[model samples]
Target: MRTEEIVAKALEKIGNDRYLLSNLVFSRVKQLCAGAKPLVDMDLKHNKLSDIAMKEIAEGKISIDRIDEKNL
Candidate 1:
């Protein structure tokens, strides 16, 4: 799916709050950069970590816990 479509679906799963979504994506990207595996399988050579993270969130392969954010 296209990045925009993936992001739209992610918003549906996460909520319409763009700021929270951005933070989630940023956090997931950091984890990806830190050597965490991609939750959604995709060609890493072509997709950016941020895109993969969004896709994972959209597909329900990843989830965010608001309560846990306090410690991060």
Candidate 2:
């Protein structure tokens, strides 16, 4: 629905899933491959995320629930 919502969802699950891997439709958006592994790693290490999924989330290409934070 909104970037805030997407980020909210990511953060909601951050505690339980520091890796931020859950849900289906957009699992690929969260999944990490060789080229994308750094992205996920950096997202977690930097405590942020790329906007590649921004449009998807905004456009409802992906669905999110909530977010949380972890100590890491």
Candidate 3:
């Protein structure tokens, strides 16, 4: 996803909850580092893990359902 699209979806899905959003991005990046395939169709060559994770979130490909926000 493009930067603008990612920002839009982040606002829609996470609102102003930066902590929760950060956690989601962190988890997704970890997953990517562990060999998980990206959920969004992005050009992997120029994209970083954080970018790909953001794209996945923007496209509704991942969620924070498994995260225990209260623990953070």
Give RMSD to native, each candidate.
Answer: 2.5, 10.4, 3.5
Candidates ranked by lDDT: 1, 3, 2
Q: Give TM-scores for every candidate, taking all chains together and pairing residue i with residue i.
A: 0.84, 0.28, 0.77
RMSD of 1: 2.5
What lDDT would each prediction earn against the true structure? 0.80, 0.40, 0.75
**Across residues 1-72, which tens digit of lDDT does each residue of candidate 2 receive?**
466776566545434353443343245344422134332212534433355443333344334442112111
Q: Which digits, one per residue and each the tens of the lDDT, describe model 1 over residues 1-72?
A: 777898899999887778878888888888878777786778778888988889888997777883155244
**Residue-wise lDDT of candidate 3 within 4-65, one digit each (tens)?**
77867875786658787888888888877777778788766789999988877777777786
Residue pairs that clash (backbone atoms under 3 angstroms), model 1 = none
Tell me the RMSD of model 2 versus the true structure.
Answer: 10.4
Give the top-scoring candidate (lDDT): 1
Winning candidate number (TM-score)? 1
Ordered from best to worst TM-score, the candidate numbers read: 1, 3, 2
